[model samples]
Target: MLTIKSVSKSFDNLSVLDTIDLHVKKEEFVSIIGPSGCGKSTLLEIVTGLIAPSNGEIYFNEENVTGTTNKLGYMPQKDVLFPWRTVLENVIIPQEIMGIRKKDAEKKARQLVEKFGLSGFEEYYPSALSGGMKQRANFLRTVLTDKRLLALDEPFGKLDALTKREMLKWLTTVRMETKQSFLLITHDIDEAIFLSDRIYVMSSRPGRIVKEVHVKEKHPRSNGFLLSKSFSELKNELLSSLGV
Candidate 1:
């Protein structure tokens, strides 16, 4: 449902991405894993029209959408929630920006808050929520934007290991229910392997697609799947690709 062809980005004399070619099929979860400063987030920014590529084109539903804004939803590395606003208020801000009536937006947000496990905490401030809860709230806000494809940049990077694992499990269920296409930028190979249908391994800056590994494991993957031989092999393969 999304395609990027021969995409390249440069700032003055420094090049960040080169000859990038990638796609995400409808409802497929794809991940880009690489070293820090490898321009993964920059590529996402280009895809979402926050920035323009020096060369190449982006397509959604086979239509040229390069340099277009609001083509998809974006959730950045940080939650960026307003401490002053309650959870429901934060979730509906996107609709408010799009001219949705306050009553209408709240009605929709309330439903999502319940679905996303934020029902009773709708009136709570960000400071009152745990790290995972805050991230879940942020995810709800992103989902309410009504976009088919969501660009996620290290959405769980700040969480502790246990929290991150729990969130990953929750995300798998989210994917199953929502069936929305995702393009994720992450440094965690295990996270990529566990959640992605396909993983793109990128080289260090002037980032290039060094490898594309398909995770053959089916969705609703049990945690036991993580301990299987197949999972170990995939992890080892990805580790080799990253030169770890």
Candidate 2:
């Protein structure tokens, strides 16, 4: 549903991305992994129109969208929740900003919280929720905007290992129900493999696509899939491609 062609970006003569070309099909979950400073997030920002690329084109569903538009939902590294707002309020913030009617927006938000496993905590403040719950609320808020594509930047980066794994499982279940396409930037290799349809391995800085590995696994993937031989093979291949 998305296409990026010959895209490049630079800041004050320092190039961050170099002629990157990528295509993401509808309902496809793609994860991008690379070493630090490799412009993984920069490339995502370019796609989301948060940053303008120095060259090339970005298209969504056949329309060229080189700059920011409301068709995409983004969850950045930080949760950026309003401290004073309750979980339900935070989840409805996007709808409020988009001029959606309060009652309708809130109803939709309630559905999201319930569907995503945040049912009873809706009235609680962000400070009262754990890191994983906060991230779940942040995700709900992003998707509530009714965007076609979700661009996630390390949504589970800050959680403890156990919580991160639990969130990944929850995310997989949510994806099965929602069928939303996502472009995720993650540092966790196993997490990427577990959740993504395809993994894009990027070069170190001045980033370019080094390799793309297809996971070849079906959805509703189990924890057993991670321990299977195919999973280890693909994971090792990605590591080798990255020279890790």
lDDT winner = 1
Task: Give lDDT: candidate 1, residue 92.
Answer: 93
> What C-alpha lDDT values do all the predictions have?
0.93, 0.91
Q: Least lDDT summed over 10 consecutive residues: which range in candidate 1? A: 110-119
Show model 1 residue runs off by greater than 4 Å.
Answer: none
lDDT of 1 at 70: 94
lDDT of 1: 0.93
Q: Estimate, for each residue in 1-244, the C-alpha lDDT of model 1 and write its tens digit.
A: 9999999999999999999999999999999999999999999999999999999999999999999989899999977899999988998998999999999999988877766878799999999999999999999989989999999999999999999999999999988999899999999988999999999999999999999999999999888988999999999999999899
Segments in model 2 whose C-alpha atoms lie over 4 Å from true places: none
Model 2 over residues 100-143: C-alpha lDDT tens digits?
A: 98898888887677778898998899889999999999999888
